[model samples]
Target: MRPTFLPSLIVLAALLLCGCDAPVDHYPPNELYSLVVSTREMVSTQVAADDTTAVVEAWFGTPVQPRWPADQMSGSAAKALVRLDNLERAAGRVYADQDDLHFGLYNEHCVTCHGVSGGGNGPASLLQNPYPRDFRAGVFKWKSTARNARPTRDDLIKILQHGAAGSAMPTFRLIPEQDLEALVDYVIFLSVRGQFERELISGAVQELEYDEARPSDGLSLMSIVGGDEESEALSFARETLDRITDGWARADDAVIQVPPETVADAASIQRGREWFHSPKALCSGCHGQDGDHPLALQTNYDDWTTEFTSRIGITPSDREAVRPFRSAGALRPRIIVPRKLSDGVFRGGDDPQTVYRRLVTGIDGTPMPAVNVSDQPSATGLTSDQIWDIVHYVRSLGESE
Candidate 1:
C-alpha cells in the first residue's frame, strides 16, 4: 500500500508554506522551473590581459540563447538548455494535473529537498542535517569512476533504486522504472546546466576585458560582447559541454574489472580481518574495532559538508546572497557525523563489485581515500586478491542482518 503523509513530509510542507498558515489543500500555482544562473559578474582584474582562457572558453563559452528570434548560444550549451526545458515541461504537466503520486514518483520525490534548480540550498535543504545534493556542482560521492569522472548512468540509477542509507535519500524501488528514468535524465540535465553556469562565470572572468575603474564589479557580461571573441567563447563552451557530456557517456567503460566472487571459506575471512587492521587498508581507522569506531574529533565532514562550511561568509561576503533566513543561534555550522558501518549496509551500493570500486575509487569528498593495490608482497598495500578477501569479510558482517 502507498504510504500516508510522513513526518519529514510534514516538515517539508511547513517549509513550503514559508511560515504562512496555509491549508493542506492549498497547492501553490505551478510555476515553470528554470535554472537560476548566477548573476555575479567577473572583473577584468581577476583575469590577466594575456591569461590562458582555453580551459574556461572550452567549458563555459557563450551564454545559452534561442534560435532566430532569440539570442545566439553555443550549440552544446543550447542542447543543455533544451534538455532542461523538455524536462521542465514534462514535470510541469504532472504537477499541473495534480497527480501528486506520479509527480512525486517522477522526481524521485527530490524537489522538496533538492529544489527545482538542483542547487543544494533547497527550501527544505536547510532543515536537513546534511543538505540535499546540489547537482550543479556535479560532484557525486557515490560513484565507481575516478574522482573527477562523471558518474555512470547506472551509478545514478542504482542510488535511485536503493537510496543512500542513513540519509534522507530514499529508495524508489516501488516507483515505475520509466518514471525513474525520467528523473535520472532530469538530474543529468540539471547537472549539465549547473556546470555550464559555473563555466560561464569563469569564462567571463578570464576572457572579458578588465576595466580597473570598476574593480569590484569586474567585466559586465556585455563587455567584449561581440564579434570573434563571442564566437570563440561560444565555440569553447560547446567543446567543453561536449567533453563533460562525453565523460558521463564513457563512465560505463571505466568500471573496475572485478574477478568473479570466490569461495568464502573461514581462512579467507580471517585473512580479510587481518588485512582490515593493517596500515594500508586501515579499515579500522574509521570503522573502529568492531565497525563502531569512535571518532577522533566530535565533528566529521564529507566533501559536501566541507565545501559548504569553508565557503560561508568568505566566498560571498554578502550573507544574504547565500542564506536567506537564519537566527543567530543557528549560524554555527553543523558538522557531519560519519556512519557507523557495523550496521552493514554500505551507502553507495551493497553488492561486492560496488564495494570493490569503493575501495579503489574511494568515496569522493570524504576522508575515505582510495586504497593503493600493489601486486608486490608487503606489510602495507594490498593485491587484488587480498582486496577481494576483505570484500568477502565485509559481506560476512551483513549475513547477521
Candidate 2:
C-alpha cells in the first residue's frame, strides 16, 4: 500500500519470471503419472523385441517355422490357422479370455442340445426327435465313407459349415472364419481325449483279465482272488476292455471328402412316406389314417397301457408317476401315442430329415423300432425305397401343419 503502482507491478513480474509463487508449482503431481511412465517404458521394451519370429519362438520355444510345402500353405492348414487367428482377435475384441472361447461356443451352440458335459441330455434334447449326438459314446452317424466309421476332418467341417439337411443343426456360416476353425480344433481335442480315455479303460480291463487268467499255485494268489463269480466277471471285463482299446488305437485316418450339397436329395423324403403307411410296416396302426387323426391311430391308451405294463412288470400307477414325464397329458389313462406329423406339438423340431433318421435308426432304449424300407424282406426285413417314401410323406405334412 505504501509503494507506488509501477513499483508493485515490477515486483510481481520479477516473482513470476523467477517461478516463485507460480500456479504450476502450487499443486501436488498425480500418483498415476509414475504408473503411466512405467507402462510406457515397458511397452517400449516389448516393442523393441516384438516380431513374427519372436512371437512364434515365445509361443513354441522353437525356431521351427510352419512347414508350408512347395512354398505354399495347404488349404486345410491355411484355413485352420486363419480361423485360429480370427478367434484370437475376436476374443480380444470382446475382452474375453482364451477359455471363454470354449465356454461361449459350448453354451451358445452346443450345450443347448448336447448337454454341459456333451452327454446329449440337455433340456432341449427332450423335445428333439433324433436327439443330439452323445459325445460320451464317441459315435457319429453321418460320415464321408461308411456306417459306424469315424468321419474325416473335412466331413466334420462341411457338416459344421452346411449343417445336416433334416435336423436342428443350423448352418453356422455367420460365425467368423477364425472362430469356426477354433471350434473345429476344440472338437478334435475332445474327440482325441475321449479316444485316449477309452483306450485307457480298455487297457485296464485287459490287464484285469490277464491277471485273472494267471495260474494260482500259491496262497498269495488265492488271497488275491475274490469270489468265483466276481473274479470271472472281472477277468471277462478286462479282456473286453483290452480288445476294444486295440481296435480303437488301430483306427484308420478318417478324412471326409466334401461333396456337393446336392448329395442330399429329396428322394429320401418320398421313400420315407411310402414306407410309413405300408401294411407290413404297421405305422398306420399307431399313427392313424393319413397321419391326421387326433389320437394317432385313435389308440386306446388304457388297453395299451394295461398290455404294456403286463409285459414290462411296471404297474400303471408306477408308470404314471415316473419323473420327467413323457406322456402327452395327465388324463386318467395316459396316452403315449407315436408322434405324428400334424400334431401341434412339434417334437421333431422342424427337421424332417431328423424325423427320417429317427424312423430308420429308432431311439435307443425306447419302443420305437428301426424301420429301414430299403432292405429286402430277408436281409433288413424291409423293401427298397420304402423308407424314402415315408420320409417324403412326413415332409409333406409340414406344409399342412
Q: Worst ten-residue run, lDDT, model 2?
A: 62-71
Q: List TM-scores for all candidates, in order.
A: 0.69, 0.41
Across residues 98-193, which tens digit of lDDT does each residue of candidate 2 receive? 664432454456555765334455567766545665443445654333334444555456667776545676677777665666566545433433
How far is each candidate from the true structure, as Cα RMSD in Å?
10.1, 21.5
Q: Which parts of model 2 are misplaced by more than 4 Å?
A: 1-117, 120-133, 140-171, 195-274, 285-289, 292-339, 343-369, 372-380
lDDT of 2: 0.41
Q: Of the candidates shown, which would achieve the greatest TM-score relative to the real structure?
A: 1
Candidate 1: worst-modelled 10 consecutive residues by lDDT:
29-38
Q: Write the per-residue lDDT of candidate 1 for residues 1-401, one digit (tens) a residue.
A: 23555877888988987544221221111111111111223233223212222332332231121011013343443344334433533243233346543543333377667764566554567667556777776888887788667787788888999888877788889866766776786677667656654555455454543333321222333232323454454455556566666566666777777767767788888898888878888888877774667354445555543343343322222355334212211122455555566678678987888888788777776777788888887766788888888888887776766
After superposition, which runs of candidate 1 have C-alpha atoms over 4 Å from their true positions?
Answer: 1-90, 96-108, 207-230, 294-300, 308-333, 398-401
